[model samples]
Target: MGKTVLVTGGNAGIGYFAAEQLAAAGATVVLGSRSDAKAAAALTSIRSRVPGARLSHVRLDLADLASLKTSVDALGVDSLDAVLCNAGVLVDGPERALTPDGHELMFATNHLGHFVLVCLLLPLLDASPAGRVVTTGSFVARSVKLDPADPQSANDYQSKRAYARSKLAQMLFGFELDRRLRAAGSTTISVVNHPGGALDSLTPSRPPVHVRGAGQRLRGLPAGLLLHGKDSGARPAVRAVLDPAVTGGQLIGPRVFGLRGKPRVEPVRGGAADPDLAAEIWAASVELTGMEPV
Candidate 1:
């Protein structure tokens, strides 16, 4: 597969590993990280693994929509086979923070930025033979309650809840996008996949190049050990973008209840997966971002 793929937040964690695997598999992998140094390091490591791999990098801060617009145009791609919206902020403070764009940080970075980026990249994706959009979500979505009135979690803010809600928004967008694309007779497939508890501690620590939270490291060692490592956690997302048999609107995750096992298609439930929720959120996202993947 000589397809070109973009991985947002491709400098570390699941994103780094996913970019590595995709580059090795012959896809022209573009790594988008906010830090230029981190992106360069990731590219170096990936090149060492896949000698002469086609790779590039761009600066993109998901918390800032202006950067998202400028960065995509400069990625040196006329088309893309797939895009992995894998970058996200997790475990912020309990207080509600705002991005440069003035929207809630977590929602803006994790969901809104990607929402606009995809809209801007529609032409490129549409030009691909089998275009795919894979969003990296999580199991925490099962426990989230997003208030449409305060979707930004401005009222009662908790780091975990905000993170979970952001992922839920991503899942809903993925499914809704598939529905819209099909209705418009487009071949682009939008798929959602989660890297269930793929911890940073379970992965090789790369110092400044990789961020490590002390508490997460302490807990992740035990939790990730009981489940899956970062490498294994990226499998479902990789499969979602690479597997020809994978269709849109289906979720892929660990075979063992999304904990630790081979990646496979898994069914989802709850209000987050509801069509009405998807429509409502989609409309809200459009109003907020002022863009849509037509």
Candidate 2:
């Protein structure tokens, strides 16, 4: 039997391309989307490209804590070989927004939601021979530091800062999970990857899911030299989940200056490698989400 992988936000953007690539590699890709219509469209798009791709969907709204358990039960799988925590929210508004759980929108969706989902799925992941959790972080995370005391950004809130910090929190959780799993002597491993400088204008058209106009292609030509399309961006995460050589706690991303190139194992630096901060963030996550992996 082929390996089964769950990819959150697999309905669009980098997540869509990642799911397609995994399907092409013969893994059973389960797409976690908030909408059934979008999930169906994504499934169709992948099937159109990869004939005989085994695909399914589970309704997942990461911001809504109440729905996570339902989403896990909906997976209907005996074991999950890997989980790609790829979904995230980038709040564009100047004002802060909150999820139904009363946590900041970006932090809840990008970090806390995946944190809880991973906790719920630990059993299934453990059932696999070599279970993997691939956390999708961001280049923006490098410049920001997370305040565990103010994880929701209540005291200080800015759109870009919150988004970056949330990603930083997710990366912190990934590394910490690796350490905990090692201490427990479990077969599961956690890896983190960032899609360096992915732009929609540079991305290829996927028809009904996403279509780039002629002008977009012409306009994005210059960026192609420095940056890359989302298809290329999805590679690092894909490699993290599939590559046997990738060990726990390793950071993966583009090879050239951390921006644009083929996926390669990158060094963990800055706040991402700080064990003290990771532990604090893990505690904050448990406090905020009321969930933790066994």
Candidate 3:
């Protein structure tokens, strides 16, 4: 195996494609999905593309902390080269929802759940010579203003804003994680990436009834051209995982306006680069997931 890699939400969309490309590159890829059936199908698909592809499917529901903990522990793996926080949710509908962890759904799945997962899996990652954690962030993070007063969005809940906040949290966590890992003198690398636009399987946060087919089709057109293929979106993530030059606190993403292009080293927005916020989020996440720091 090239390296042991785990990708959350690898059942479909950009996650699936990223897993496919990585598996083809000879990595031992673990597909983490919420649905066992979906994961099985994704594994089958990868095998079809890459003969005898080394792949395994594990159940991981980003909205449920217990599920993540149980599934991760059951993996029975000693070490992991890289763990991709590729799962996400876009709450575009009118209603607001909460995760099983009692957090705002968007924040819980997109940020907190993965936050807990990564921290809990640190031991496995640390065992690798060059362990890395790649998190999928977004351009919307630029627009989001982290409201520490209302981290859960309980008092105020706007669909786009919540989603954006979650992405912002992911970015901040990646940066902060870099600092923490370096301080501990661990070889683990933590980095963030954003696809910029819609990938093949852009899943909406709300139920299907809330989305219009025509609107989704129209939105996906320009996105299809600008957003990038599954492999391209995976570039930054793969690079962050394998590239020796990617240092702590660096972001890897497209060079173009917002989408399809090569992976380039980038920086987190100044407004979003507050160490205080990162620390606060980190503490909050640890409490929320009940996962003690390593």
Best by TM-score: 2
Cα lDDT, model 2, residue 131: 98
In candidate 3, which residue pairs get closer than 3 Å at backbone N, Cα or C atoms, i.e. clash?
none
RMSD of 1: 2.5
Residues 222-249 of candidate 2: C-alpha lDDT, one tens digit per residue: 9988899999999999999899899999
What is the RMSD of candidate 2?
0.8
**Per-model lDDT:** 0.85, 0.94, 0.79
Listed in order, each prediction's TM-score against the native is 0.93, 0.99, 0.88
Q: Give, for candidate 1, the lowest lDDT window spanning 10 residues.
A: 203-212
Give lDDT tens digits, candidate 3, residues 83-137: 9999988878878887655688989999888888997789999998888889888
